[model samples]
Target: MKEITIYLFLLFAGVITAQTGSGEYSIKNVDENTENSDFGASFYGEKMIVFASPKKGVSLVNEVWEENGQRFLELYSANITDNGELYNVRSLKGDVNTKYHEADATFSKDGKTVYFTRNNYYNKKLAKDKNQWNNLAMFKATVNENGEWVNIIPMPFNNVSYSVGHPALSPDGRTLYFISDMPGSLGKTDIYKVSIEEGGYGEPVNLGDKINSPSKEFSPYIDGDVIYFSSDRPGGFGKLDVYASKTDGSVFEPVLLNQPINSNADDFTFIINPNTRTGFFSSNRSGGKGDDDIYSFIEIKPVEFKCAQMITGIVRDKNTNMVINDANIILKDVEGNPIENLTVNNDGTFELHVLCETPYTIVGEKSGYNPQSKTFTTSNEAGKITKLTVLLGTGEIVENEIKPEGLPKELPEEIVKVRPSTYVVNIEPIYFELNSSYLTKEAKRELDKVVDLMNRYPNMIIESGSHTDSRGIEGYNLWLSDRRAKSTVNYIVNKGIDPTRITGKGYGESQLVNQCSDGVKCTEAEHAKNRRTEFVIIKM
Candidate 1:
């Protein structure tokens, strides 16, 4: 009994979010017929695609070759309308179709040269392997002056003992990629490429460990630097799954395309038109019209990074309802570490980036107005911006106190007494690295001033608030901000201040002083303005 190889794949399963361009794909059967297995589609001319099918037709039906108990595959063409609908299905004309199997074809850019896979047959004789099974081979044919595919010649690498099929050409037509179980293969069936030159072909080079596993890997389709193929290696959703790998020269890293592109059955032959982002792939999964059927897909518009979550808002007076220009605003994460500090614009508006799914606090203050703070949280949705309005009560300006020098002209020193003894000190923004809460040397230097203040006023109690830019996952940013806030408090405690006198909280990207919310593009400097650390007076 011939042992049938069952190719299965183990894959990482997770909920596909909108950001990875996952949910936008809509798949449907492409003019499928119930009787035969139809698959392996490649672009043919302007409005048609060529594929292989084993269904009975008018041309000729010879002896049946029972490999999978199906008739020999033959090349067929179908017209695709402007609306991406498939129609006018028929067998390819000329002498291309023969008694032996013929399928898996690729065309040159000019559509003159066609390379395809077929059973090894020369002069009405079948080439067989040691097991009495016919081995597959590749052939090339060019359009002759008579408008027919003539002079069919076998590829130089074809052999009677082993199979070499599934031809794919590089964009420049200088390289041919194919699958073979011939000598020097790392897997049962591996994808290999040979350099195509003017004379013939160069050495067949294995794609190496990056693309091939101990299992089967075939059906390679190249579009620019990205190569889409089918593999049965571990970590897939089914027996076979479609995968994509990007190549920088000779290096490749395969990434599995999760469902609905892949299913729990054999899925292969993925080809796409890069310009339209529309393509076709074949699968034998249930619900198809036949054993194997072609499915079409179109990419949804506006692919976005799911991590880009932000918050933006403005500050206004309590009664006047007017935008507060140049008002000092501080943002903090849930753990109470300062994330950013900014002053409202001349129009009483400010924008700050914040992380998603995190709680934050926005504090707005002026020298004479009553200091105000509001706490809110962000959501997990990408490209979502949270808006806010801060109302501060009017108050009288007090006598002079020592102010930090070289502060931005827009941000003046604010001294608001919380009690007869304690006063709020509005400090400069404290910055951290992207996606990091670890304190930098600059951060240490800035915190040193807070240490000095705590030491000078031994009875003072302070709250450290941390904030982050809206460039990462909200929950993660909140956690990072919490760490940052605690790090700040720890620094002060290490400076001989009692730990009980200081507390830290992280306020994620719930408050923005400007329009730098999710889906809004901002510069690094602008995002830097949102990541800040602040110290607020609690008691004295």
Candidate 2:
């Protein structure tokens, strides 16, 4: 009784015939009598190729079905003419046939190579354990001279101990898409891709849950940014129908291929030829010769948008202007869109990728220097490299000005007298880290004050001093204080201050205003007050 039921089920499965019209298509001269012959895929404006079995062709028929049996499948290809007519139909040579079950072949856009799946069609006895009998492998072939394919190599990353098949190439040929039964798949079979990198194929990335369900989804083809694959999930025209997906950046969302395109049988392995509305695919449905056969369809082309643009620039000092290597450069879009920011190379050059036609604010910062900022807009018309040059200025100093604050009121009138030589001037604060020589924010603020004073007095020479608190050993404090004072002078020099009129000195612990000295316990704040850094205007 079970045998009889299986025979009836096999008998009900049918085939497809030649179809026409803008969106209508069919498989021609398909020998449906052979059950294994099915699922053909091709791109528009390219040769139509498929996997099907012939009764007496080069396709070897080793294993035969017993339910009113004698069904075999092999891979075949047909040259599609410009007018959408099929011609020069022939079976693909080498690695394509194994006297076993082999069919379902897809070609790259240039038609230089092919990726297809082949199961244990050669394994004769269907062991009691069906799981052990379902192992399949995916293979590839590159076209050689004389227009024949050679160099058949098995795909590396997508292969597994179980099965791997149904390969697709992206429009730009930068990605390889295929189906596999590897672990972590959402279904019995799932779609996956491996990026084409500089050295070789990159690691595989799964199509994720959106496209592959607990059911089966396979046969992936890429047109522009859209991915057209096949799936047997629910809500289709039939058993296993074709589905499409749109990819934005790195994300892909599935879109069902509805209506007359998908039917109540198994419709899959579809390819869309670029620039044309026509495409070639495969299906196993009723209304024709036998079990499974090839089919074709037509679809509208989709619009594509640009993703990003490249920007490059250099950072240099304004005074003794030299390129500052390894300086950090940040670019942010108006909405604060951030990408992988970069730093200046050893040669002081940096590059960044930003969205086109977007407003971006940039900030360049480095140690021991003031932060620089600028705003810029990027557009598609601009080339990959948009050059942005930046020059950092140093702190400034002023000369010949009266001391505004911190003056002694007890000084005699004669001592305080200007004598026509009192140069009123302000010194910019050279920033320093807490208890360290590293520059700080407060330091830069002091320098700005110095810059203002310089604009007021242009001819006075200025002297800067470095001092340290008495919390530590006098020797160490001396070196730290000296570095702090010199750093202050360097800041002013970089800020356009005249080097000839300025001097720096480190007092170490030699000078002290308060009684707090080494070994004298005091609060950090009090110690900090003792660690204070001060700058004085000598000749001004």
Candidate 3:
């Protein structure tokens, strides 16, 4: 019977992942009801969850169907703790539970109306299909003044020949999504939705290929723009991997979630709280207490962006082309207020953080070189770095003089032609952990300096070259290095540097600086030298 098939799928479709978003999560079984299956959980109230369970001696009705010697499914309520643990489990009161089946209940936004799946049974008579087995159907109920569900009625679309169940309501309660095997379905079972009007329900419309594959698609849940569901189609971790898709009107293209959300087992019936970014789902995967158990999860947060707008470059002697170390670099705002006094590094390089969309004047001078000043503006473009090369000439040291208020300063006499100097400076090598492109704290700190340099020299272009240790295969190392290079560049770009000013390349183990090549034993430090990132000036 179709009801039997649906129950069998619920028992088998078990899968899960521990985390889903910007925070770490701990998942655990709701309770120790290991002897019987418990799943298809949905939020009941603020701190309670209503789920379907088939534990022995819990059903109130006598006309129960048995599968594997287990009682038919019944709706139960349980209180969930803040830490995602379940306790105080009990069955639903009033006339909601029956002998045939009652499960997969979803509530309206107000929690006053409930739509659920169950067998078509009324007045102690079961609605059976041609094979003498009952067919699954959807029903609705509303809470009365006595806090009990009254006015229970079967959906108008229910039929004995075909099955229609798994009801999920939209946030506004204006639309309902469900799974059915009625005529014109794309597969054995496909998801269908209908508009709920004040008068009655509209005709069921198939969700189409974007959602319903030739393989069965069911257990539809919507939160904001995303629709979460389960599918047994190809390219999944197992028989039924939970999938999510961004809903654009009536269309959706689902993407299969990776482990540990999906395993080599069936998983379905997912529900979540969008505000807390946490929820529960059922999985028949290994390491559970029951045949199918409800597990809670929270999503893990990702790395935060910390890089800021920066400028960096070297100060050099124009005639001699020598690095000018310890240069007094003064940065001033557009109104001539001193912003910062920078100390040039030994390599004649200086880096400074600057505000975007503001103009600043930079004055660089060594004890013996003439003071050189340049004016530039930081653009509003994000993640861009400006570069600059201050070419100071040999001349009589100029003294700081204060002019009379409102007086024009004297201009310097024209000097003979002086050639601009050019020199190469090696940046500190960026190190990474083995076989990963993720930016380490140290790596980010180092790239922050580069961001300052690129911000200072707006017209300068740089190349990020990354290499890997020789421990892995050359091809794999190359791929890893490529990702590392891009990762490094992306970090700098995210700091407000222009992406066009930088490029990345991976050398793999082909450009080792030491004797840590393949087939050669070397110390970890030696191999580490090869796994490095370098920034070279490509254009100025």
Candidate 4:
């Protein structure tokens, strides 16, 4: 009866199918799953991946459910190796673990609070409704001073007549989405969201018809503007197919994830970090060590955004700090193909409406001023104004030559010539520490000079280009340098500089000024020369 109750109560937990595909994604099964039923994987902090299993894991107490001849599910986290292997798997500490079911955990941004799915059992007792049927309930816990999760409590919405489990939280932690067969559900089980507020949980809001089918919709995971879930709806490749619905508050159409990721089995609980385009999902497709397994996927091709957006730009003189009425602005795609030509008004502002998720560059040129270009990317979101500021009439400065008197005098030769018109801030080549994107103290101090320079030159706009010495693989260096670029931009933005005034790009080993290309024997100093932060003066 306990095993039967647990399986039925796990309304959303199930299997997924798998088939091979082209370059869009590459999928591989991980060692997180055991011979028993292991599923419900979520990233727990930086170094650990947490999930649930019907095996005695972290807690020493493993209570088997006689009906299935297997132990009930418990939350277990394992260390993730650099090469993406699982190690040192252990059950989660604290009263959160129980003889009943505990799974589908989501962590808050601060990592202070955790919410998970557990059987109605709590406090050493089983909770059954009027018919003696044990249902699933959502519970919350917090880490004590000793780092153990204590203070376990069921969510206020938990009820005896209905089951609520498979919890997923928004990154902000303000909205909690979970699967339930509670009152007013559209199907046997539907995904519902409630506002997580200061006082208590807000009223549960149904995700509505767009996402909920008459069959079922469960295992909801939010990644940026998209909501991922699985359903046995009509037009899918398997019994359950994972679908991505473009959601920005209101729901859009649900697009099924294609072959390789979804097969004729049950695929659900998809989670991803959009920035890295790498994530984990669960599937029971064939060739697994268990009934269901967690698989890691890497997106070789990014999902395209179809939403339209408005991009605007304002052109001004870098030296005079005045709007240029005769400025010419050309919008080009990431590949440098011209898409739209904008005519600047006498007021110096131009606007272009285009689709989101594609990177564009705005080139501003005037008869007297040197032509300049500013690059930016649009989003899949709505009502956002992607704007750019073009500063013209600033002549290119020679490396180690044009030193503003206001700059710190100790660094007189503070520039490096990257290109004809591009100058890189040569305060230090290695702006970030080794193997890390975090800005160092010296990097911050040098960036302080940039904040001051921008403050002095109101129309001044700069582009931060992060570089890497040819030591690591191409993909890794590109990712690391991109992180470095964003980190530097964030620091300056936090210092009260307008985000629009600064931009960032990563040139991983592609723009090396020295002979330290990959496989080339070079000293640490020579490599450091190639691994430098390029603070290029886009305007002024």
Candidate 5:
């Protein structure tokens, strides 16, 4: 008999909103946020987002919940922008927006089915159990071509005796994840999941002790096999904090998210699009305009949650064997995407707290020197220090001709210099369309040359760095360039090339061939040189 108290938000809904309490990333409230609580954001379709709020944008319902004096929560839908902002706020269409409380919803992959949370209001009346308790329940609905939720039906698993709400569907739309306070719950609430289909539902299974702490756990969101939820358990920032767990069969090991995502106040209802690495979460942290506010953020770095280690590496000049503290360092994953990039420490040494059992590459770059790279793999053991070194050197550009044994026959035999002692096949320049990351047909044609070359040389490794002209916002240009590099690398990987043999990153507008500075007058042809993508042979 858990009572709806202040900690539980008086039955308003699952977790919501965030503030820049620590400011590691950019986060702002949704456009429709008001003085009342606004939280529980979920994607309804490709271009729309549906969330729970009391703003009452276009709904006719006027009833207020006696439990808290706030208007009953209603589901609202809005257009999502390319930058993850919200607009065109309106009440969701259809009879699903009832007079009773409605919050926390999840949609199927095809955008046709939705599972939502509400009070156990059935038969046009409130349904209570023998204990005179109004339990929370979940409902199923279908979306019509008109964008309205139709065919509303109570889920078969709903029971008047216990509460079940905060629904999230699995990425494959095969299982439904949710929070409940059923008979065997470990706390006031626990996350549960069950196989679901149009025919019926399977028995709910508790997520287990790892995710279900003795304290309350709610607001579950699933992306692939990973689950994100909010809990008021021990060892958090303070009060409720968002936690993530990777599921291995029925077992899970939950890890607490870092600050800025979790603050001293309540933070929950976390959701993310893995492709773009952008997400939204809810929080009641201070500095927000309302009781709770939804926040949108871009992931500057991905959080790793495996065995940990402290990796130390040094950058130096290959010829002089002297430390180079001012050199730029780029850390890459096995697949060759930049994981972290920065200048090494003043001591010429850089340390990274990284995941164990992973392969990594470190690239050292200096203005006057040719780029150099070193690759290493972390051990499975934790708390050990490993050493790696990168040395950069330059050589005179030579016009001599040399044909490597495994080189493609079509490539010109003319050789350009490579890091003091190598000459390799050249890949044509890869360019992109304006403000776009998709690979143009010409870019693919050039990439195929590199792919064929790699297939011929199994020992060779390459790095593709994409650049953008200094035409748009600097930050946006960087993000766009990263996308372009990723697309190019992905295309090669899809064609038989091993992902570990290639890595890439976007340099954005940082490296321009000419002095096409932002404030300077420059021709489109000159700027176009800055938009080119370069694929350098890192190892051969």
Candidate 6:
């Protein structure tokens, strides 16, 4: 019923803003070109990566494209000195860069990997065949032991559908969110997410109507607890504007940049200088040499704060103990505020940083299995690093028989149109030991359905509710039910859904779809049906 706010990235060229107070943005032009243009910037601490002039002598090739009447730009990278000067700007060499068009470079949190978008024709018969027309797929390169990047590969998420580009890696390097105009999109392009699995990529999920519009939104960045992206939606300082949004335990809403920060020109593709709190973005406004130029700004800093007690770890199966890909992992405070949401890779590992000296709940889950949730208190502060391990069980026994009622029959018109195009994540149920909450093989079978659901709705919120038969004492049953429900939620949340979206509720034999009571002889099938875990969409 209410219109959902979305963000669209607009490409422009200009510079705006002056440093406030004593804060100074160490500004530098990564590329020096008086006759050409360069932009689309990304940062990894001090090092910088971007795209720039593709003219002869400046680039390895000598070819360009004129969109409206001019040539499209190329990609480049540079290093930032300690004093903030950028130099050694050069075109990306090797087989990755053709003479067509390339831009938007991103680095992994550990700075060991790089991902960027390229547009043009390449002769990759196996890889580039998906989108032959607009072969704008994403590619990656990893830092080798010799300190040089090697072995570039195309991201698996790209296909023959629409174009995919503008990839941004999460601070933990476990999640990657990018833009695509694939078959399922609310607008010209939509933001999508996929897990970094064992050096590969899992399936991609659309970020939903909240972050995408009928216009266009691109260049996403995930820092701390907020997501920053570019858009040309209404009420902007220019043809394209920058916006910020926070994870409010549910969906997100666009928060426009304050006055003076956004101009009436084209401003888009921005990155924050992590070390200095300064902002670096690109624009196509006046005073620039060509179509676009890079700019820097100083952000208004709040009261100073530093993180403590950083928790990091790996997720694996209890038996056979292999890394489970795309497992949801979550860290939350006692009040249910999500501290971090992480998804494990095919290698079954994750990392999280937070202010310590408090208590926390760590949870993990995958499809076709039961969740694994545990509690651990942090005595370390932000700087203190802690490592932990989590194990999950597959719920194979109960998955085949357990089937809930159908989904809501009535659907909104807009939802119906987009819903079919969206992914449907399915997690199987968790099998408990006979008459016990302890997890078993059957439990994991059911949990897999939950993982599928999460993959389907990257922006939707979920609530995990636990139920039980009327067999034990009211108090005991309530506690057991709570544990069961929490256990289910923990498995997937730990796999990496926002813990805030998932809260466990234990009815303790309060609500029953069937009649089975305490101390009464009942068929195993009847009790099995009563012992259940369910999830609901709280926000779209």
Top TM-score prediction, candidate number: 4
lDDT of 3 by residue, 294-364 (tens): 88887553111212346777777878878888888899999989999988999998877776567988888
State candidate 6's TM-score. Answer: 0.50
Instruction: List TM-score per model, in order.
Output: 0.54, 0.47, 0.53, 0.56, 0.55, 0.50
Give the per-residue lDDT of model 5 (tens digit) for 131-175: 777788898899888978988899777788888889998876888
How does model 3 score by TM-score?
0.53
Can you write out model 6's per-residue Cα lDDT over 361-427, one digit (the tens) per residue?
Answer: 7778778768877676654222345666677784221111111133345543222221211212234
- Please give the CA lDDT of all the candidate structures: 0.72, 0.59, 0.73, 0.74, 0.75, 0.61
lDDT of 2 by residue, 30-92 (tens): 332334444454542255555455434442334454443554446666677655556666777
Model 2: how far is 103 from its true place, Å?
A: 2.4
lDDT for each residue of candidate 4 in 242-277, tens digit (9 for 90 to 100): 787755532234667776778777777777765567
CA lDDT, candidate 5, residue 185 = 90
Give candidate 3 regions above 4 Å deviation.
1-5, 10-26, 55-64, 249-252, 301-540
Predicted candidate 1 versus true structure: per-residue lDDT over 9-38, tens digit per residue: 112234222212122466788765555678
Q: Give me the displacement of residue 519 in model 6, in angstroms.
A: 60
In candidate 2 the C-alpha lDDT for residue 293 amounts to 59
**TM-score of model 5 vs. true structure:** 0.55
Off by over 4 Å in 1: 1-24, 58-62, 249-252, 301-540
Ranking by TM-score: 4, 5, 1, 3, 6, 2
Residue 344 deviation, candidate 4, in Å? 48
RMSD of each: 22.1, 27.5, 22.9, 13.0, 13.9, 20.7
